[model samples]
Target: MASPLDRGGLPGHRVSVSPLDTAAAARHVATTEDGQRLSLAEQVAQVPTDPGCYLWKDASGEVIYVGKAKNLRARMKQYVQLTDDREKIPLMMQLVASFDYIVVDNEHEALVLERNLIGQYHPYFNVDYKDDKSYPYIAVTHGDVFPAIKYTREKHKPKTRYYGPYTDARAARETIDTIRKVTPICSATCAEWKRVRRLLDKRPDDAGIIGLICAQKGRPCFDYHVGRGPGVCAGMISPEEYAVNVRRVERFLSGHRSELTRELKEDMSEAAAELDFERAGRIKRRLDVVDGLDDRQQVVFPTSVDIDLIGFYREETIAGACVFAVREGRTVRTCEFIVDKGLDVAEDELVAGFVKRYYDETADIPAEVDVAVDLEDADVIGQWLSAKRGRKCTVHRPQRGEKRHLLETCERNARHALMRYMMRTGYADDRTNQALLQLESALALDGPPMRIECFDISTLHGRFTVASMVVFTDGRPDKSQYRRFKIRTELDEANDFASMSEVLGRRYAPERMADERFGSRPDLLVVDGGKPQLTAAMRQLEQLGLDIPVCGLAKADEEVFVPWDDTPVVLPSGSASLYLMKQVRDESHRFAITFHRELRDRAMTVSVLDEVEGVGPTRKRAIMRHFGSMKRLRAATVDEIAAVKGIPAAVAQAVYDTLRA
Candidate 1:
């Protein structure tokens, strides 16, 4: 018998309702761009009675939200009947022009597909975790003859084992350094290896060359002399010998400490029995390193216990989640995530969604998962995790005992994480409210500028000119509302004023003003320059017939220039008002420069490809699509370049040569 969690067993159908037949019920529905509409009743009637994922799209056909349901028709009825009490639901319904769904085998498949689609589309109404930093990982190349352990942020390569998405980059680097000391693995690209390579280059190539090199008996690197590296570069160790150390490092990192310690002890004993005191001493050192690492881990349970505890601290529409990964009775790792709860979602739903998303990216899965809140579908999530782990797994909420106590501790850490995030982003604090008030008094505004917009222009000479608009709501960045513009006006030289004016005109145009995505007009407008930029912005607003307050922030003197005054208002050095201004200004500048660099680099890549013979626009595009960037293209060999469609071997050679040059 097939388990309920089985996926992709049979093809399911897609259900969509046409809008033409539902004209009588159109009052309850939003219309599409092509005069098409579907009433909530018609939508609910057409949905099939099956488990699946549904996508709610806006009139512009953009997916605004994605959800899963055990019964599609029943779920549709709930939305149509306006039963969900989430504050954003009513607004979402107003914007939802249409919805469609894909039937699946069961709720397990629905859950999997929903998480995938959410990750793919990043629907606005979904709970998306937004963190700018990419955690570092300890990566070991699996296919290399003598594998090397490395610290990397990216994990896209095939046949590579990645151990972590460590929250602390310094800790990841330290782990790699420690592994190098204990494993004696050779880093082929290190300075010591390169020095050895230079010596090999001066000698004639022969079958016995490595043996002859090793016969010299001189240490090729400091690490070799210090016993931190196998003398692979000096040809003192074979690949087979080096692999033993590599496996030891892998076992140590994989949390198989007991087995690794046992194996090390056996090796040490064998070495001593053979009268090899030196090798036995080396093995003893490795055992000490392994034991030292184990000693640092906090013991949370008996040796048989292995579990993961997830705790959350939510405030309004945002939440901070912390994970404590326990293995072999000790807490091995901790990770933190920040979730943007766009709607009023329940804590149980939040926990389930987070577990599914978090486990999807991680390689390790424990036998049990303890969450801060009880889940409605704990069994379903456990089934999914069990399938993922190829073993039985359980998801539960602890009621009492050490697990509950530890869970409370995890929640406290989660609270700290949230507090740190609030402090870092200047969100939801008395200080932030005071900063807004300070700005209001300093700028002599009628009220606090609750919605502040800052504009900045970036360019290299006269090339790839761009403008950015950054929004701050309630004294914190509202990144979703941020906008970027490419300066359409051609200029012989960089013109900050002209760029600023063009961007302002485009942003406040009548058509854009009516669009809901732009939201309400900003309470304050700030340009990233002095009087000239401010005057240019003011002129644009006057032409548009708008009376919003405008100001300029000059970077040179850190002075704030208002349209009503000639002398700049110098905000107090340590004032929150000045700090807020700097934050907004710096963010806008960074956003503009990032966009500008994207365009500039794209142009540079095309121009560089143009230098190669027989490489036309089509071929250049194919090459760019294949490699994604100029750095990757330059790293490609001639044969790899030839693999791109529409390019011949000769042209590939030419392109490769040009890129290298």
Candidate 2:
């Protein structure tokens, strides 16, 4: 581990933190939320060039942002000279009074610590990092007498051997089928075996009843005949034999083809020498099949490093990303996500943004992230990955060689996924178009509901008030336009109507409303509750002088409420328009509840010491005695704050910086 002090004087690293250039940082600090007068540049200069996660705190000692860097000092410097076009950065900067960091041993450790702290703190500006969906892993119930090997959409369950979110579900099924053919392991659906013991009581012990129940060919299941599939029927494949075959299945799934084949070949020879001709013949056939499969998987990378090839395909409102897991230089697993109404950022920016969020908390970041699109923060992200993996990770654009070929394959898959996605939804699906048209008529809007915004509030008896604004563009989620808010007013009071009003006011405030993006008219506005919510929004729009169409969707019966009417405009129970509203409302609810939980979590972690800088009990009492409330002290100017007994001018400036931001 390196020293936790400045490493600016050392060699081979960019020392972003330089001694306080008071003129540059102090002025900016005063206008920030922290209101503290510490020179950020100076603070950066003091930060050691070490692996760690940095926390940006505001005047109230609230963590506003969290990020990790291999070189803490250098990363801090990057922020001090911010050219952040991601509008939120400027807002976050305004509240950043002071910065703190946790040093760790390596980059991988830093990644882990960073994610842990983010979940713990829930910083205001940090994007909520959650894997929206998890892929299927073949969960081999190793703990059971009958180890059921099947595809599971969930990840991480105790006492199970899981392999390959494996990308393509079809490919995984095919692989499992092939493995079963080679060595028929018991493959039974949970439902098939759920009440076997109870059902078996009526059957005779002498009859072949167990096999009839478990091994009987059922539809396209068992992959092979009952006897060949080694279907774990009552008397077939003992626990010992089944365990042996399960190990082989695990090896093959993990991409250890060569080693597994070698072991099989040795076993076949030994069996033949022992005069076990049938067993030897079976082994020979299985080995040949495994060898043939390996031959088809031509090695891509010359050196056997596991790398993931990532590719992107975007057109207009739809974009797709494909990730190909190259294990031992073979493309083994493939997965994709089709993003609807994604950000209108550049190709590289899109790739960078997706990659960051995709593996932001993934502990298993590949050593070489071969991206088809050059990442904007390749070096920074690579450092973070390297730290997470406990080894240096290389992230760069791959243009030529085998790596490039793999990336091209990924791009092809991505394009296909996007085409399939569009085909299933958008213009190809007449129902979607009908739904949008129906929504417009149902809400009596000016035109089709091309863009609809929905609001939902979530809190526990109004404690951690949070609201989510979810946007739907052309009847599909426009995630980039979504926003979450921590309701700052009326703390300790549960007021949905009031919170709804505040969110609307801040969302469409005059200054922000001037921006075309913010001002562009939403075709429809749907609130997640009934008359009271609808009235609140209707009155808010009147106050803002905006004549936007608004309605409320109550869950009790999927009823819609509009202004000037107590009776809701109820649609058919099975109407498509109602479905769209339900989706929008549900999405908003999910978003709000998620954000609210984070706020509650952050509140739980805060301590009184977080509010003041360099102030202990003695100074705390003196300041409290003089100002009474912390809010009163925050309103004081630097000189007035300095005038307090036991307070220094520098500390007073820090206080001013903290309070103002």
Judged by lDDT, which candidate is best? 1
Q: List model 2 lDDT by residue over 503-609, tens digit each.
A: 99888778767876563668889999999999999889889999888999999967899885678998643345766788899999999988988777556423342
Worst 10 residues of 2 by lDDT: 1-10
The lDDT of model 2 is: 0.70
Each candidate's root-mean-square deviation in Å?
Answer: 28.1, 27.6
Model 1 bad stretches (over 4 Å): 1-36, 85-87, 143-147, 155-158, 185-247, 429-661
lDDT of each: 0.79, 0.70
TM-score (C-alpha) between model 2 and the true structure: 0.45
Tens digit of lDDT per residue, candidate 1, span 1-661?
A: 1212233333443433333224543433445456565465665676688888777888887889888889988887777778976555666788877766767778987887787777767887777675755667787777654567777877336667777667778888888777776667766456755555455556535324554565474456677777777876667776667778888877667665787788889989999999999999998998788788887888888655779999988865578888898878888788777877612467776777788877766557789999867787888889888987789999989999989999999889988988898889866676578889999998999899999999999998878999999999989899999999999999999988888889989999999999989878898989999999889999999999999998999999789999888999987654568778888999999999999999998888878888898988888889889998778888899999999988899999898788777
Candidate 1 has which clashing residue pairs, if any?
none
Question: How badly does each model clash, as a count of residue pairs?
Answer: 0, 23
Per-residue lDDT value at 523 in model 2: 84
lDDT of 1: 0.79
What's the C-alpha lDDT at position 412 in model 2? Answer: 92
On TM-score, the candidate that comes out on top is 1
